[model samples]
Target: MLRTSECNSEQNVNADGYRLITNENKPPDIKYSKENSWVAGVQMFVSFLLAGFGMVAASLLLDLVQHWDVFKQVSEVYILVPALLGLKGNLEMTLASRLSTNAHLGHLETSLGTLIIGNLCLIQCQAILVGFLAAMAAVAMGWIPYGEFDIHHALLLCASSVLTASFASLVLGLIMIGVIVISRKLYINPDNIATPIAASLGDLTTLALLSWIASLLYSSIGTSVILPSIIIIVGASLVPVCGYIAWKNKFTKQALDEGWVPVVSAMVISSAGGLILDYTVSKYKGVAVFQLVINGIGGNMVAVHASRLSTSLHTGQKENSVLGKTTKLLLLMVIPGQLIFLYTIGYLRAGHTSLTPVFILVYMSAALLQVFLLLSISHYMVLWMWKLGMDPDNSAIPYLTALGDLLGTAFLGAAFIVLDVIGDKDSDLGD
Candidate 1:
């Protein structure tokens, strides 16, 4: 959109000719470009606020939705949930990451509009493909475990997933384009801000869409399969059409070829995390309330780290280790940032006060550990991906954020187990 206006509009067009105001004529603001500890801290803190709130809302909605007849009748959606949600990291956040990297490398200056449109289309195409595959995986997981496969349920998951993903990607892609363009214009680092914002918003919107669509489809299942069948077929039909268009675009062409492994792999990884979520929530219901917050925060932060390092690699900045300035600062940020949300979680949710000093200690350790390990992984992962001639923006985030989800979810479950063990010990001693 900006391409038609800002990219071409002449500053002085009142006379016989127009004057182009080039980047050479307009210098970037000194304040916005220079990121010190304070600026980075402020950005990270503000982002964490939005991230925490959005995830809490998504988690609450999920808790409510799971009780509905749709989810209860067909449990396969549980298997699909994390896999689809992971695409927020895989498709949408990766788009943000790619846009941020392009912005930093001055590609935006040359063709911001084309970059935005191409990347947005690419993400939508990816969302369709991955969403379809994730649905299949969910259907298989739901069937193989029970030895009772329902083609009706299978079709529902596929339709719900493809439609939700396509809709969510279109919505989130627009938001990403707006966020990246505005961040660049404001001299803020899109890398620092874009991925988390996309991710946080993606979780909320995608969850809402998925629940609503699934419920609608579930209600109609007894009467007709026509609706669901049309959805899957049409969605399948678009794959090649969108794929061809994305392949034609220079900004997204190479990405079409090399990034499938990470997306599909990340989906499988997140499914395991989702399985853990199911088990943990069954034993400790409180786990669902905060799992989204803790696990989401971990993934959001690491996704940011991944996005930044990817931008760095694209800019020709050699990153030899994970112990650099940003790495250390981000690592230190995990404790304070996570504690604020943990406190908020305690304050807002009822009867869920696992905020005992002992529990807090365990949770904080998990938060810090999740972030630290993910940062280290992203650091080297991005570098290695870049060296092997694959685009890190496309490949690295899916894996890192998926791993972040797995680690964060597992550690949270572990924290609950630890709290239980200590409580049992205290009771024995008291008795």
Candidate 2:
């Protein structure tokens, strides 16, 4: 029996020159033993770089906030924004985690039958259920305007979330499968590429879908009681029906059993962050872009940690043993990424007229604090879930990303406040 520790080492040369098997069930042909940790880390970082671009693109959604009357009038849209963005990222990350695990285990079959369809069902089901829940939760949290938490608000949230999630999942699911296949062909580990790629695509596609669909639904028939009512009833009804199917279907059972708790918890947490973001968006110009970029990069870092740890756990590595390596690697990778985010955002948003040293210091300080907190949280969370016999893949990304959003928003807001206070002090000194 090959021990898991040896799997991490360079491939061994046995007496007959046969490679050691990573899994007893799968042959050596399927396992990526030679890829090593550094290779995997580099691949993940590259994928993350690409994911960064997708995240940056999500800033376009903020343009709607600046320009569209509908988005401007509906405070609920801000509530919907974080939840929807987080939802898309959460679902895709989860899906990619699942697929990566499948690829790692050599269980990824030649035909995309059971694996693909079951996961799709799971993604769509969660999208529908979570979408409705997110809207309701937003209302409960009072993220809506004074008079806007009515039937129309509920209908718009439910309809947009459900419809957009369903559409996005289907499209994103196909894209992930293609990515996995290509990675295998290219001798790259799918585990390294799939999650970030899927996550990036999820952010870009879902934001576009949610914005267009919500606006389309609201504008054409918003005033009519019948349209929103139909959306509410039908969408609400599908949740349980989908739940029942997920319970019965073998393909989707793992997702149903394991996927919900974390994703829903994340959505609720993200909605809290959304509340903060919505309140502060107008007060701080260019913060919307900051929120999207920080959350995206922060969340992707968590996913990387989670995916790497999940693969480790699945391959029989001890949780504690892998934790240090993951942490060190995460620190190395996340620092440069965060630096890139801070410089790009600071320069693009603040540099046109004048870039102050105080502003730069505050931005770096706040952003670093967020990243430090996130990395520490992710390390412990993955280990804790593993110790508890829960799957980290199912729990980690959702919780971490949501919390990342919450903390990222808070940190960014606090930075702005610091900048304001210091600016005031400087003015007084001059006088």
Candidate 3:
């Protein structure tokens, strides 16, 4: 009886030991249950699908909006559509990225009324300036007759559109941040999801706002005193509101403390350059001054290099070779794209309407080229940084985008002049 009891006890001990080993080996599977895994897969799939659709839809909507009746009546509206939509996308992306970072750092607040209002005012200022310049450019190029659309009318319509779009973007940015936060809680990647979604939404919202503003302008004012009066009232109200915000936020002090001098100087220089270019193009007859302006502004690629040098100085990082390579790659890609865009604009203005097919081909080619170049440069830069024992994300890609815009515009202008002069010589000989 004693021997039989001992054998049973030994067998029970062996069984218990096997159970422990099995649990330990199956930990990974246990940690990821079938339900949890399925949910994660579904979420990721949905996010990616939405992102793809959003990009495609936004592109189509922008094309449709450009051809809408109001814009068709004023052909310069074509240029305005791209400029405004690009600005909207860029701003929304910036704001969304900032908010996402803040959310990650636990610094974002739900109360965005003040922020939204402030952004709206800034956007209005930008839109008015851009609209005036665009209209003036069209007039100078003879794309639109000068007296047909006054600067004031353009400014008012633009301001209304900009204000509406900017407010909508702020709300969208907030929503994107919230989505990002939720995704993070679910252990999903937010960076891959937030920016693209925000940009797509911004594009659609901008088109809608522009359409609504056009409707309002046509129905309510139709080129009259009421329109001007509304613009004045809104502009006046914005001044005080901006002033109040500046005071409440202590923006002056903040700016000074945070190295605002360089930034402000850059902005002032850029704006002044733009205005001078506008004036020169409008007043002069010898050359395409708009192209000159774009080149002058775009060629100031010094900002990115300066930022890089500053980073290197502060961090004692030695990556000059990598930086040079990346910058060269970007310039190669961006310069050609700008040139093609400028060429299309010049040809279109010169009454080469059939060149539209060529323009489309060039645009698509440049876009694809830019994508590949950007990806290559970004990958190499990141890889080089990783090799050097540093976080690539901490580098200045964000600043690069703005710097690229400036340079791209300048390059486009230069290309336009070259192409236009060649075309003119051919025409003169034929005549």
Candidate 4:
């Protein structure tokens, strides 16, 4: 039997050989070009811009729907829009990242049968749960009155969002895999290309899905609109049946044994922890619980990745175990710092209302800057490690994601603090 190390090494060799053979025969792809670096940067910048626009657009739409006589009866139902959009983007990003990782490992199959269906079911369940929580939070915050909102409307909106988002995720996953494959053919590192592209596409897809769902819900179209929704649900449900038939005919049950335990374990732990943290924060803090839950989960994921990296290194499989641990430790330290920063910003923003525009502009500017910095730094770090012979899938991608999340949160929090300080000084001078 092959040892784990031997198996890993063999995989790495195969991956490297594949890359070399493809590059030798193909022209460089778009992402491989130095010119495309600027293109990717521009795309990412536009994504950030669109994220802000999406939020504003959602807010305005909510206001409009709230005032409409036709929607007045269900106006409170509109509050779920922002939350659903947020979850749509987030879940799409998560699924995209996982698919990208699988593609990099050459584990991704083109057959859209079982894998696609499984993902759709999982994402739909997740999206529905998130939508419900968002609706509940909106009620708790008095953003929408509890008695004004129909639970059925909320459920319908949640179902729509999940179906649309899941379909968008599947399409985006397909596109991302193609892009990565082409990038590999051109001698470009797919890791550097996948996340940014997938994230941008995820944002765009989320916006489009939100708009489409809203149209379906509010348009003159009747219940016949439900046909599309039903089709998606039925299609997803059929995946397991088809997969079982395929397995029974061509493969043994033993084939499913590999990596099942670890994948299931990670899913269970992450999902449970996410639920508990979300519940705890929501009960105590209300809608603002999103930031804290995101921070905590992101931080813990970094800790877990650090632990895994350390184990891998000690077993003589890698050289940069300490690097992973060190990066994670630094990010862990920054968590408290981030919380303090967020609190300080909230206090200042509340106290200095006159400087609100300045505060908002500065805060947004800082967030953009932080995103750019985080992307650049983390990208290069992973590339450097890869050059030093680390496996991109096992060692680089997880750490990079964790680091990006940690730094992104920290920088966003810090930006708010800086803006607050500036606002405070301006207020003091006016006094």
Q: Which is the leading candidate under lDDT?
A: 1
Q: Can you give the lDDT of residue 290 in candidate 4?
A: 24
Model 3 TM-score, 2 decimals: 0.49
Sorted on TM-score, best first, the list reads: 1, 2, 3, 4
Candidate 4 local lDDT, residue 278: 32
Candidate 4, residues 227-298, lDDT tens digits: the string is 445644664564455445424421112222222332233223323333332333223222121232233223
Error of 3 at 191 (Å): 2.7
Clashing residue pairs in candidate 2 are none
Taking every candidate in turn, the Cα RMSD to the unseen true structure, in Å, is: 7.5, 6.3, 16.4, 10.9
Q: Per-residue lDDT for 199-271 in model 1, tens only?
A: 7898889889999999999888867889999998898888788788877777787777777888889989998
What's the C-alpha lDDT at position 145 in model 1? 74
**Prediction 3 global C-alpha lDDT:** 0.39
Once fitted onto the true fold, the runs of candidate 4 whose alpha carbons sit more than 4 angstroms away are: 1-151, 220-361, 364-431
lDDT tens digits by residue: candidate 2, 1-431? 11234223233434533232254444354347555778878988899888887876776456444446556755677777888778755787877776776676665653257667666767777887788788787666653355434666666767777777677877987888788877876778776788778767878788888788777776854567676567667866766776776566554575688777888888988888888887777666556666777777777777777777777666655345433765677667766876665566445552111235676567667766776688778778776776665666666788888888888888877876676666621221101
Candidate 1 stretches with Cα past 4 Å from truth are 1-34, 350-353, 424-431
- Model 2 poorest ten-residue lDDT run: 422-431
Model 2 alpha-carbon miss at residue 88, Å? 3.2
> What is the Å distance of residue 370 in model 3 from its true position?
0.9
- What is the per-residue lDDT of model 3 for residues 1-431, given as tens digits with 9 covering 90 to 100? 01112112221123212101111111132222222434433433344334334433443444344445655454444334334444432344434433333333222233245444443343344334443343344333333435454554455455554455445644665666566557556644443345546544655566577666765664544456566456545745554554445334321212122222222332333333333333333332222312321321122222222223222322223333543542453344344434544454344343222233443344334333434444445445544543443322233233333333333333333433444554532222101
Ranking by lDDT: 1, 2, 4, 3
For candidate 2, the per-residue lDDT at 273 reads: 89
